[model samples]
Target: MEGDNIEKNRWACRHVLPLYASLGMADEVERIWKVCEYDPRLEECTAAIEAWGKLKKIEEAEAVFDKLEKKLRSPSVKLYSILLKVYAQHKMLAKGKDLVIRMAESGCAIGPLTWDALVKLYIDAGEVEKADSILQRAAEKKSGKPMFSSYVALMDQYAKRGDIHNAEKMFHRMRQVGYASRFRQYESLIQAYINAKAPAYGFRERMKADNLFPNKSMSAQLDQVNAFKKTALSDLLD
Candidate 1:
């Protein structure tokens, strides 16, 4: 009878947990977790943390992480990264930094996910330079490129600050890392140029080369850029 209950709980963790989490039923998730007799899998624990994150329940997320650590005796790097991501989402810079340090001391491999989480933590904390510095250091290592979202995060921040040069630099670097240029990245670069009140020269052609057509929002932005360029040209002609 006990064995049968454990098997049912394992199945519930695999299937029911994610479904409840996605539905924003945090209470139900907690209830299911409490009733489980077997040790939860890493993915199951991650799902609980993510559920709390989506609801912006930082303490709840941390509690789940604590439980995972107690159960496993040593959680995996991915588990640590997911918890770090929850901290990042809530802009808990100090906590995130401390977690990263603990991860290093525990010899958890700082793979792309951990690097990405660290970058995001700094970015959300309004420390763009620090985030970019981490990104550069990560790139110097042989761990391949940081995650695509890391590049996009810096690009979005640079755009928000009207720092067109760095935004463009990030875009190019993202491409150099072999990440296919996507609409979100293109939109961010275009927004950078728009915020700087500068023309995004050859952007349309570049998008064409990537086989990406402008959507409604992007088309509106491009029109503004064209108007700015035309005004500048007319002023020069006069």
Candidate 2:
């Protein structure tokens, strides 16, 4: 062992790199990665992909993705979606879009989570029009499929954007598609309506149409909600 050259230890380095990563020694893992004769295989790539994502080293994960050949990149739609979600979690919207295109080019079925992620990223980026466009595309692409998450994300996006009419329209469409509105979505729309003061008539009509009302106890809850929302808004302004 005293006469061992650095080159002679490369083989051992390859075997121990993953162990280092597993032990949370990211810097050591990177050091070994740079010096080791690491062969890029699907299993290794997959493990690196997962490890980098878990560590929130998104750029490093993207680097691993770049090393993989297209043929061995993602053998199934599920894995592709998993990686896309990882990109979305990093707020890498452009990368997510490119991955979606790649999944489509490979003839993979787009799952609800992928669509939901796209919609959310667009919304978070304040690209409401683009988000709407994506929803339209999703409607066409997955016709006859129930996508409750997608619909809910879109509705939340519109509500957050203060597009109550469009949000209401989508809410109706969701009901038509047999999706019951969640309480969060309902509260979001209600809060948006109240904040904007755009038209209480429509809000009142819709609430009545949906058989929802502010009873005495619910009015108390609404008062507290309004107070909290006002405080939050004030804090943001301050």
Candidate 3:
């Protein structure tokens, strides 16, 4: 069992836990995971956790985390972040937030990327105010660059609520932080304006170039928006 080829196989196995998750082979993944737990390598544990998370096996992933506590000296921040990400993926925002706080209290520095995951989850949940609070807290930190993507997300949320003032604030923040104002960002705001029956700048050309013909529902919505405006399709095109 302790031969060179066996050694090579073991080393190779160390790398495949992530692969199993990517390939979505949950049973094969668990088989490899059990072997890693018995042998107990740090990299293996990390990979196993990630594999489980990717497969959306949150309970199994948490089980591995629980099992590893006795064997590893202390888990790395990367490992904890992965676990937080699993919670977020499952829409368990409160659980994810609690994990971050616990990890911080235990002196593990959960970074901005970790916070961003929770912000995304809150946004998906339509809890825009909560997402804003999380972004504000993360910004208050001394470290990390400005999260431009967070502002874009906030812009989308504000647009959904038809809060143009707040959406504009986020758009300015994105500009201040040097984020390229992407087309989807514009679409969200335009959609908000259309829904609110308000005048939206650059509406027609953006729609035509966006190749939005496939969506019948959206096309009908656009017709309604078009009715209120004085400008024609040609005007928008021009």
Per TM-score, the best of the predicted structures is: 1
TM-score of the candidate numbered 3?
0.69
Ranking the candidates on lDDT from highest down gives: 1, 3, 2
TM-score of each: 0.86, 0.60, 0.69
Best by lDDT: 1
What tens digits encode model 1's per-residue C-alpha lDDT throughout 124-163? Answer: 9989999999998998888657899899999999999889
lDDT of 3 by residue, 1-238 (tens): 2235533567655577788789989987877766567666767777777888889988888888777765664667777777876776778877777877877776876566766776777887668888888777777776574466667778777877778777767766665545666655665666666656666555556645654432565556566667646455546888
lDDT of 2 by residue, 92-126 (tens): 77888888888788777776666776777776666
**Steric clashes per prediction:** 0, 0, 0
Which whole-number lDDT from 0 to 100 does residue 150 have in model 3?
68
2 or 3: which has the higher lDDT?
A: 3
User: What overall lDDT goes with each candidate model?
Assistant: 0.85, 0.64, 0.70
Could you tell which candidate, 1 or 2, scores higher by TM-score?
Answer: 1
